[model samples]
Target chain A: MKTEDLKNTQDYKYGFTTNIENIRAPKGLNEETIKFISNIKKEPEWMLDWRLKAFKRLQVLKEPNWQKPKYPNINYQDLYYYSAPKSTSEKPKSLEEIDPKILETYKKLGIPLVEQKRLNGIAVDAVFDSVSVATTFKDELTKQGIIFCSISEAIQKHPELVKKYLGSVIPLSDHYFATLNSAVFTDGSFVYIPPNTKCPMELSTYFRINASETGQFERTLIIADKGSYVSYLEGCTAPMRDENQLHAANVELIALDDAEIKYSTVQNWYPGDEKGVGGIYNFVTKRGACRGKNSKISWTQVETGSAITWKYPSCILQGDNSVGEFYSIAITNNFQKADTGTKMIHLGKNTKSKIISKGISAGNADNMYRGLVDIKNKAINSRNYTQCDSLLMGNKCGAHTIPYIKNNNSTSIIEHEATTTKINEEQLYYCNQRGLDQEEAVSLIVNGFCKEVLQQLPMEFAVEAQKLVAISLEGSVG
Target chain B: MLNIKNLETIIDNKHILKGLNLNIKPGEVHAIMGPNGSGKSTLANVLSGKNGYITKGDIQFNGERLNDISTEERAQKGIFLAFQYPLEIPGVNTNIFLKTSLNAVRKAKGEKELDTLTFLKLIKEKASELGIDEKFLSRQFNVGFSGGEKKKNEILQMKLLEPTLSILDETDSGLDIDALKIVADGVNSYKNKDNAFLIITHYQRLLDYIKPDFIHVLSNGKIVKTGDANLGLQLEKTGYTSLS
Candidate 1:
């Protein structure tokens, strides 16, 4: 990396530009570019064809007409389809060879990657700018028959596994963003825990989009085999930029018979400047499939940063006795916009699902919760419950909820409830009278409001996620 | 320890507390008795720095003009109000909330933060003294607690916070005899030579447990008359009709 690049990256606490070299393709997306990404990763022929097919479908797919997020016209031809870190002159035999600026960035973000050994039983895969830079605790995970690494590496090493389940639930034509992500996604994590293996450690990935003007399109997939259980954590941050960069990622999970997967995301991407000049436009598609009997999948996300975020990580229960759950806390401040929620589809006998969503809006931001619950005719005795609540910190901000439930079976019991409210000045006064400052009281109250979802995170990530929420909404209150 | 002279307050242009005047000296406990809609709670709220109330006149806490100070500032200056209906804060452990409030007060007083062991020991001792079980400390603050339990919880907070000028805003309204006694005993134990209390109540039942030095009849948002503790017994027997 050039000296100027390193200088630019260190300016942000999360984005530390790298100096190492990388193989780069020009910035643009097309069928050939998609083919280039697949060929460069040396993926199987079937996977390459899949990418191409998804690419063609993407061109024909129309932008979604749901919800009220103002997404600008994205020029696919102008976005860089692929990016990755430059390989080292010599493989990093020690931490000394790692870029100090990048490590310093993570340290400032409170995620010091160099202290992996001290993290204790948790594996970390750190992705910088469009590529997986370093993966730790791989040896330990490998001992337990678990694959924890980048999807690109997984495609090369575990082609059959990736091919068998990629896009199985969120197919190429599932939605506009999902199709676009499927076509030109660059890199994300892939994990598979074999049958009956209780994952010995929590798995995590720290993603940083550091490069300027480069759109990031990453994809992640996790699979838990029969009777297996795994918990995964994701964290994101970006550098300050003058123009809004697009980030459209896709994540898919598959749980086999009696398996369970718990996924958590703490997103604190760089919001625009205080005046709302520029930021990242985060659009993502994440879905899971409960394929085997009694399988379960749960998603918990704390969203605090993004110029505009449009995502609804969902679950499809296609097996008997399967379960799905979504717990989320989405907060926006300073002219940001977020439209996020979840969908649960029950298609099998005795399937069950629960959704709990909390949205907080402040500083002229607009936040919305859009969720769906669908029960098919074959879903006998299915149970679905959804509760969505929104808190507006100031009169200048906006919070809205749009929930849709389609039940085809009277045997199923689906309950939906939602409410919208503003943070009462009296509550703040009460807290302050107990000796809390304005910001501290707001943080305490908001955390209290989202405790249901924050508690769902693994113990380690829960603390990190809490700090992320505090940092994201630091200046949101009076 | 606290003084308010000709204090007037309005909410949304409606005068709620009109020229209310009362004085509380250190080592004294004054009970302000009133009927419903007499602005008993409004007086407590205005004194505690709750926003959205237009105010006139002045309040002095330990000689500091308190009209411009924030609620937390007043709390730091040793004012605690036991709410009539304590707000339920779900997901916040009772101990954590107590400790945070305590530490905030201590920090404002230029004191060091208490160690976890010391804090826990203090909590255990006080919780037992107030008849609060160990389990209550681990649960969310006042969540799912019965009305009497909620009042007791407020007293528990007052005990832990140990403010110099503690205001009990109808702290006896929902309490049973036993709970009321427990709450009054907690308040009585915290009283000292340099501390004062402003206990607002509609009934005189709590006075049997915690003795008051003076009683004031509040009507139409003003203190109409002031007398000794015998006045409380007389008012309870005669009702506010005679006082009005």
Candidate 2:
């Protein structure tokens, strides 16, 4: 089969739009727009002050250009900073009371909002566009002293908890995109696991982008108290459009003494067409801080969408004997571009971190892995190991790895290894000779390439992520 | 049955096989012996439909022309080639690879695919029969396997696939006396009246274990002589230089 024939057979399955009235903020980014977003959410005075400060900082910040992916200038003022479905104003008391169209949208996305039809034992906080539509299993979570809700409601119901840890890990002046998100962020999920308590079930959030010409800036904050444990999963998707959309999200995690947090994400935003006309520009900042002794944090993500992706979920190991781990599989196909990795900073004694990253690029896409490992002067006896692998399917695609390691402590050890490989024609011929077709052969080989990273994902997400990996690489080889 | 007439194969603008002809009927085993650069592997590649080979021939397999068919289609049609140097595919378990190949061939033949339980049972039995450790089934395909183990793996695949015409390319190379017997026994157990074997080797040691009905001397892309099993012993006494 020809490459063009294989390309023609692939179509985005979640490209359909949901028609609903949207209450959008005035198009543009400025102090007034930030105020408008805060006022709509009825945020507290201190929260408004924080957004104002972040907006002020964002004004002087410039978007970093030292990455592998290149794109045209982004006109920040041309994008609507905030947009929400009209039904969000009147909070629905039950799933049936919610707008059927919105319910149907989630249903079509395979994330049914109806409690009975949804995956049992998993609590969901569904965020549509810029607002939270519904949060299920809240009563049960409350019974177990676990607080899981949208960030907006968390600010209203648990203001003290929200204010204590909101930018503690990732400050408002962290970076360009993060500062922007902090200023104009609308809604995201928030979880607070109490001390010495193990969460009863997996906490999940489904994010959807339906409104056009809007930028989704969500702020997620998760706090695991001392001796607590929690696992969180996030999934996102956007509608197909002729104009590129922007998604700048900020996620912060805090693990206290003896606490552990596991965060997993499967992002499938709309990638531009084969001609590279329209898609989502995903620039996200996700960071976690192990603030107390013996705390741990693990981040597992499978990124397979967006026209341009710039993300590095990082960890700051501040507690003695703490551990940080990162496992990622980022696949780019067609006109997509992704530059993602992780950063591990050891600030305490006897800290350990491990990084595993797999990148697959096909079609005309470009994928890069840029990671950093820093062992501070106080981090004696610390150890870090990093492995990054890249697989290029077609000649036109590109894969790059840039790793930076700095060890200030004499007793610290850091090791970094990287490899770039192409799919072997001999291997493909061998598979073909065993009665497997071209696509099946490619899928099998690519799956083998990404087996390490895929094994890190949760059970349900692992299966979906494997399928996404195969779908993203369709028509990449001839 | 397999037939080839005026078979010529050119790779990278170099003619590797010039006017090669051969015919093998069912229930028969044929051994092709020659020195280095004798186009033994090229014939196996062309017969299995590998790329980068331009051919001028009328090759018929089971009464159907084989040139136009794809590699997978040819395999589905019951043609198997045991590679001289089987590629190691890391992260693909041996059991999974064999099961997928078996199911693909079965599905193409209009047979029900084997479930995990049935496939495991079949593969374990085959592995034990071939003297392969049960632990080898869980490892990556051919990765970290010794040369003898890799050859055993190829024969294990042939047993599971149950192809009508099996071509063993250099199956005897890099094997100890014990390893050679295990591989030969694997082939002997799978042999039947409905299937045929084509063994390509550089030595007569392999033929001593699995006797061939006919021995063809392949030299410079074409067969120079044809004889019975005694011909293999004669060539062992006098190398290809004497035959040429």
Candidate 3:
């Protein structure tokens, strides 16, 4: 097929908006908006205080400008800080009570909320437009002492757990978007695995931005107690709009002694049109803390959406002999821009971290991998290995790697490798001679390039991620 | 089964294959021997329909004009070129690559794709026939492979793909006597009366194993001489300078 024909065939499939009554706090950001959101959730006074403090910090914090891709000015007040489906007022007791339209929307996204139609061996928390619409397999999870519910419900039922772990990893004084997410964040999935119990099933959260001009500020927190293990997956999608929507989400994870948390994300939000008219501005802050000895936190993300994506899912290795891993495949097509990578902070002895990032850019898009590996003075005998690879599909696209390594201890071992490669005609011809067309050949080659990171995802997600990688690069090569 | 008439291929505005003409019938083994820059590899590339080359010729395969079709279409019609330097595609497993390639060819031929179990069995059989172990199937395609191993892998692909017209471009380069014999045996075993072979090489060592029906001497972008297999022996003894 001609390259031109292949171009723009990857229109966002999840761009249809669900028509539903919304109970929204008036468009804007202020102390009142935070208080209003907290009041709607019926939060305690301490939680309100936390939001007010985060709101104050956000006021003082300026939107960071030190990034690769530049965008038009964003007026924060023009965006509705909180917009929840009106059906969320009286929280549904089961899937039957939830609005059928919301359930149908989830079904369209390939995430059926019905217990029988849901994915086997996985519990899903469906969050739509700042509220948890339906969380499936709740009883099954609760039977195993696994508290899996919305963050709002978690705060109401187990405030001590939410208060103890919230803001512990990412404080209100964190980055600008993170501070904002802390202030008016409406709802997200909250998972807690008790001590000595491996979670019976995989926990997943499907986030959808439905309301127009509403910023999605969802906060997700997961805590795995000592000797426990949990594998969590998060997927996001949004409707296509001419005006770019804002999504600033914050995710925090804590793994206690001998615990492990495997977090996987497949982000497929609307990436705007061919002219880059409208899309999501995804600025997310996700971090995991290995707070106990021999703990492990592994992050596997396949980011292939948003017009402008600025995210770095990082890990803080604060326990002796703890291991942290970040495997990512970030693809930018058309006029999209992605500045994503990971940060590994080694603060304990014998800590180890591995980062394998693959970035693909096509069609005037720009993709960058900005990562930092910091081994503190107390992190004796720490080791880090990072490999960042970039593949540019067309001459008009750009791929950049900015790796920052700060090692205060001489006993630490750090190895960094980066490579920038373009789709070579020779390779394409070689593949063509073996009976594959240009698109198939490009997909195969790109999949090979990202095999290391793709292998890190779970079996089902790996397949989806591979297809997304191929679709994102369609028509990227001539 | 293959014919080239007045083939003139220019790459980068520099004439590479100038009015080269050749014809091969089914069950024929043809070897084109040449020195460096003699356009032997260019002939193979052009026959396989690689891009970036301007060609003015009548190249027909199976009664169809091939110049207008894409490289993959050419392959679907039974054209295979064993690269002189096999590309190292990291993370593409050798078995998967071979399976995909074979399935692509099969699909074009209106055949069903083989299941994973069937494919694994087929590859294991073919690989062991070429003295390759199962472990090589799981590794990245040609990544960090030794020269002999790469050449053997090319032969493996050629055997599994089972093309009607196979073009082995300098397959013996960088091979030891043992590896060369194995590769030659692979090609000889794969050759049958229904198919053809076009071998492009620098020396007569490969010809010693797989006898060629015709030996064409390529010099200065065209065929200078055509003779029997003994001609290769004579050229090995008396260089191209003597022929000129």
Candidate 4:
């Protein structure tokens, strides 16, 4: 590679916003614009009416100012509410038939349409740019009565399921981002495993935001019925663009009696340039509800990208004898900022939750771990344990932890522990002395720090997340 | 193979090595005996390019100046310094670390890397030579290892890397006589006409197994006296107050 190419490689990776025809409003957000989006997607009359109600609620809502390092007010009118591959009139049935430009973008991000053949048991839905390209292993999943498809396709094929559980966990006006997602959300994944049938393979969705000046509001809903089990993985990467983009995703999951769901995310969005110019403002709301006795739901996320991230994937323990868990590793480097954690709300008897979070800050980045655990008066014998550890790679970075606990139940046990530490130079020297380069040493140390979180991922995605950690830390090390 | 000239070092604004000068030729063994806080361990660290302050010094190895290189560079150039306190690196297997280090040295020397089978054989042979159990290779590096086991593992690395200049910093500090003999025997087997040894210790017990031609007494960061193996015995009996 040429010297010039090396500099631009990092540049183009984050700045290459794809050229695609989009159905967008003239400029900003208004009731008319919301109605325009609903009309373009050809939504039913009730959905359009729902979008209007959300838009009205958004007018009264105010942007939260409690977060550290305030961002310039986002011009709602400047964002394109909708974008899709203009060349594709119909979704491709096979990986080969997908648009070449769209496929090439995912390839550059190291997530191709084809599974890394070694991981044969995992099914992948490759969503390029704005739409899902091809859903793999559908025939096999169908054999077990599992419905895994794009959310849009699910709305067309299984509307009853979508309508029944779409906004159950996160109400339309739950948060600012969730409100926006409920308004103009385009495409995400839908997974429904039938009662008593275990998912035959890990289901995954790879998301890419390829258009400039666009906001990606994808809605994902996963349902595991009685006595069923499923593990799902989600990954994302966006090409570099000078124009800051917005991603407001809403993910809701429902677990019925004796059912279990594991959701893992490796989020590597475009985190702007080293100087922290134009990148993704990733604000997402994900929540799961254990609605039946002995149900379980867990969320594990590794966030290594995004210029500014505001996310809290939470769990509502509303089922007796249910279990909830959240494992997360968030990394912020080079002017990036992350304020992420999870919330566990216990409203049922004998409910339990575990939260383990690891954050790494390098360069001049700032990261914070903010979490909440609440036990209601009816939640008898509710229990929770939370551990948050932050690793600061350099003295220039900052790490913070904020945990909130509220309990009205007399028999609840809640504990919280947090620690902030810097990577000791002596440790680096020791690792270097063992023949690992500075980058490798950092990767090794960081990986060890995050092993707990990564292990929660599906085996195949766990390996992929490990490699992403190494690549993401490149150039940040000595 | 190793030369130190008026080596003056300081750490945290306090001097550690003051006007210390020593030399070791190929095929020779040099033992440094001193009281606590003497410059013996500092000498080993300085030779291995460890970071502290060198207020005044000149170090040459194999006729090449050594102060400007990185610790890893010095290591790749056949200078091995067994740390007094080997760090515990969890999640990194001992075998992986050893192979990576060996390959780094080999690559720097323009030699072919050893394959897995050959590497395992060498490791087994070296482990047996040092009386280290085979199970140690699969365990995390230095994690949960006893003090003697850590020292032996350091020796195991030295045996694998086969550095031309080996500095054992207090390798005999926390070892029993049996472990000390095993460690000393490991060092003795690695000694050759093409390599040199710089053994730094507070006591003279290790010299009984691995004899040194020249013994030096360091006090207050400077070499105050130089003698033969008898000097170590004298220091042990008389202590540094008389020598200083």
Candidate 5:
């Protein structure tokens, strides 16, 4: 590596790549590309028809440019729609059958595909490039009537569930990136918790983007049946590359009567070098629908990566007395731009929602929190509370908050609170005078600022996220 | 020991400390008295390695050049400065801040850091000795603390860090008489043959509780007069106008 390139990989320790030969679809976005992707997965005719519909709609749909962060145009035709590890063509029944190099890559990324060696005992479905390479804890979960596997497998194994709730929450024609994802998304995790049962362990999926010039388009669908509960975790990272990569994923969740789904994501894709020469453009659309009375959904995310991240994991409260929550901590450093928040659409009576967003911007980065809460006239006596806080490290960075509220019901209550603070020299000096270095002081103060949202994560992930929060802002100070 | 020679400080092109010199050995508490705009706080800030100041000359602590050493390095080497206006760092719990600070200093000193239980016990005893409520230890660092409470917290930190050289910049400004006495007692009890103090104040009020070995009256960015502890009483009677 050149001396200049060494600095790019230092702070982002997940910058190495495995030399696995790839079986890739031809470059470009056309009917043939979509058919090729669908054909490779051996998806049923209905699934291919759904992709064709999305691909047809994508032609008339224009990309939304109303975001706070602007970027140059993306050449859709020059990008590879799908690239999977060649060995994954023949499905691996066990870890022994899986390619050794892919296993080593996961091991290097701190995700052991071996079920017995899972550090947190989480049942993880490891997705590499554009394929689901391995999934753990299958038999244990199967005994409990829980189905956790790759979406491709689900399409072939449980097509009825997939067809029933695949695009129910985030429709195929939602927006540009979402439609694009719906058309080309190759693989992601599929989880289904049977009625009246609680998942025994945390279900997790770790996404990795390795092949250069390949856009990772993953489609995830999770369904929690009546009287059931499940907590799902998603984590992603990519190898350091000089060319910008795109990751546009669509995640849909459905909660039935008395069921609840808690989804948490820790996204650490490789943000570009300090000069913003290259990184991942993470544009994802995730939404959950409360389809029956008393259903609940919570979204918690700690986003500290990507060159330009534009996502809003939202919830549609269509069930009476259903609850929705969003807790987010988005940290942007060194030319990274993140515009993320959530939306709560209340349609049922007495529904409730809460949002807590914390954004930290440093080293010429821009962070924005844009959220919306809409309480329809039918949603009588609904309540919503929102809090957004921004912490700035340098004068060059920017923090913005734009909250949109539409409450048509007189009896509904909505409250919004926001605060923006700069990392003042006095606070830094005080900490330093008490024996902390510049980076440690910044990290301590930032961790405190993010404590409210960080607490929403699981215990082990909270610690790891705290350390990642610190590592993300490594060069932000003097 | 702390040493200074011809220290000149210019902040934003305005000379604040013009050719100021001071020296103190262990077991000595020196008080600097001056009216407003006399660069009393500027001296303390420059000593603490605050940014945005242009300084010339030398500051030495135990035969080491502090000219280029960072603020945390100065602190790790046993030089502590209690700010005149201790910052209200929101969201940071007081107990956690104290533990992290204590551990950092301990680690830098080549010592093993204390466990949570031991550190908590030590901090609890220190807080009670100063009459601080135990509940205040868990609240956000100085977020809703009263002026006097903030001063006491500063004193509590002084006791915790136990630096070789401590500079209290206007520590008595917002303190009530009772709080002032407690703060004075904190300094008095921490006083030993191995540690020293430099107290900067606007009035001789704090000196009544913690008597100083030397009193320096500063005017127009310079220390115009230096005398024994009697100088404080004399200044209380005559005022700084006489020295000018």
Candidate 6:
């Protein structure tokens, strides 16, 4: 085989850039850039003030270096904070009016944004570059009193809901990356399910980063009101480039009295080439709060891409009899590094939490699971169960798990289980002897290792996540 | 159905099967009885195309050169090896693994693969022959299974694949007498004029249930004696020491 052809085989299968003109903000993170972002969105004055506050707080916060994966310092002044497709400058009224190139991108990614070819039983809000181009099934969702639209539109049409929930979970002065997202964040999906309602279809958002030298800082806010239930899914992919792009998204979820929120993410951004030349630096802050009694929130993620990942989708069980659960499968291969897990905080009486994390590292990659389970003094009879399993492929890779458990209440209980294992050659041989090829054997075994976490995803996402689990481990086996 | 000539197998630079020779035809059941460290399992592994073995000499299966075929391809072309200890794969449902393995072999042979419903029906019948519980078929593949249950699973796989040549590597080592009968019954029901068996064991008891046409006494790294089924009974009276 030619060297070029062999190298292309290892490249991300979804590596294609869409050529489109983008109206970009000036390359900087100064107050002017923040004001420019706010004006471009035609935001209200209060929102602009909110952005300035976050930008002011961001100046004093130091970028955290405690993560295991380290990269060169980001030139905040050299990066474009906002890049939106020119056609989306005046928000398109419908799918017919949206730019065809943006629709084509989503179609190539197997998510048809067209009216007739839409995915069945699901509503999708396609976010291309730094703008939410089109959101489907809005009318149908509106009939059921569910608000599903882009955060930019939510700010315009449903400001009260946005104002009531935005930063209510992850506050403006939360941390470095999160505060940066709050200052100049672009478009992302926003969901609000009213009380005593069950969402009829799965609500989803597809994120694509196509602009060069632009950081995608999208913000997602979901609120499930009293006695309401909603399952929201987010998927992301990026075009392969030679320069590392930053994706710092802030996703905040809130569940009210007797409400349940299921949030799932299948993150398959462009991981760098074999030598780790360039890829997405995914530093995201995702947190959910069960704020009302008898509320529940579940987070399921299948993270398979990004050159370096620093993310933890955590949950706060703050209401009486509330529940929180996190199921994740993070696979890093070919010079990728991930320091990701979740935290469960029990602060209410009789609260409960469960965490199941599976990390698979291969091809000189490092995968770590750092988690915390804290039971406060007020949380009498609280219960927490955590299981962390790591699977390593080849001696060149590494897997690490760090679990912190604290129980201040004597009546509360926290149980932890951890196991570190290598992909057994004998198991692969046995499967091969049963007629499975080496690649197929590895895929099957790895899928088995991630079964528990995969089961937590929606049926539509579970099948795709299972295949991603296999594809992520390709070339790691003989 | 199978042929091996001067098959010298070395694992980790340790020559185990030094110049071993074997031949078997259709509808024939061959048993190899030996003491400990007689290279019994090595021969089975070599025939199954397992790794870590540096092999020299020719092995032909169904008239094709076996040395070049991969382990999965060998099974696709009708060579089956029942392992002594079935490796446990957690979280892989037994039924799903069986269906995948069966379909892989079937697809390689250019046969249409069976769908899930048909596969379930077919496997249910086969599992019933060996008395495997319906719940065990849904459990994780071989994980937390008893020694006898693991052996039964191997036989179930052997029956599902229906290979022309089947090699049993100490399958009766941990099976009780009742489980032995079930395994023997499974083998007996699957026996046909187009298929053959190569049973490797340390005892002659399994041979009594599923009698072999030829009994080969293996010692050190090669077969030292070859006779009919009656030889197993004679060797039982006096251990492998007499043959060596």
Candidate 3 CAPRI classification by DockQ: medium
Which 10 successive residues of model 3 chain B have the least lDDT summed? Answer: B87-96
The 10 consecutive residues of candidate 2 chain A with the worst lDDT sum are A112-121
Docking class of 4: acceptable
Location of the lowest summed lDDT over 10 successive residues in candidate 1 chain A: A6-15
The docking quality of candidate 5, as DockQ, is 0.75
Docking quality of model 6: it rates as high
Q: Model 2: per-residue lDDT, tens digit, A1-478?
A: 6656665657777888999999999989988898999999999999999999999998899999998888899999999999998987866778778899998999898885667744567888999999989999888889979999999999999999999999998998988999999999999999999999999888889999999999999989999999999999999999989799999999999999999999999999999898888999999999999999999999999899899999999999999999999999899988899999999999999999999999999888999999999999999999999999999887999999989899998999999888999999999999998898888788888888888988877787787888888888777777
Question: Tens digit of lDDT per residue, candidate 5, span A81-172?
Answer: 99999999988999899999999999998886897775577999999999999999999899998999999999999999999999888888
Task: Quote the lDDT for A45 in model 5.
Answer: 99
DockQ for all models: 0.60, 0.77, 0.76, 0.46, 0.75, 0.84
lDDT, candidate 6, A1-478, per-residue tens: 2356445556687779999999999998899999899999999998999999999999899999989999999999999999999999999999989889888888899886766754477899999989999999889899999999999999999999999989998999999999999998989999999999999989999999999999999999999999999999999999999899999999999999999999999999999988988999999999999999999999999999999988999889999999999999999998999999998999999999999999999999999999989999999999999999999999999999999889998999899999999999999999999999887899899999999999899998898998888878878875
TM-score of chain A of 1: 0.93
Model 6 TM-score is 0.98
Stretches of model 1 off by over 4 angstroms after superposition: A1-23, A39-46, A87-96, A475-477, B15-21, B34-39, B115-117, B219-224, B234-244
Please provide TM-scores, in order, for all candidate models, with all chains considered together: 0.92, 0.97, 0.96, 0.92, 0.96, 0.98
Better of 1 and 2 by DockQ: 2
**Model 4 misses residue A472 by how many Å?**
3.4
Q: Show the lowest summed lDDT stretch of 10 residues, model 6 chain A.
A: A1-10
Measured against the true chain A, the candidates' chain A TM-scores are: 0.93, 0.97, 0.98, 0.94, 0.97, 0.98
Runs in model 5 with CA error above 4 Å? A1-10
- The lDDT per prediction is 0.84, 0.92, 0.92, 0.83, 0.93, 0.93
lDDT of 1 at B112: 96
Pitting candidate 1 against candidate 4, the one with the higher lDDT is 1
Model 6 residue runs over 4 Å out of place are A1-9, A117-119
lDDT of 6 by residue, B1-244 (tens): 7889999988988989988899999999999999989899989998999887999999988788899678999988889999998999998999999999999999999999999999999999999888889999999999999999999999999999999999999999988999999999999999999999999999999998998999998888989999999999999899889987
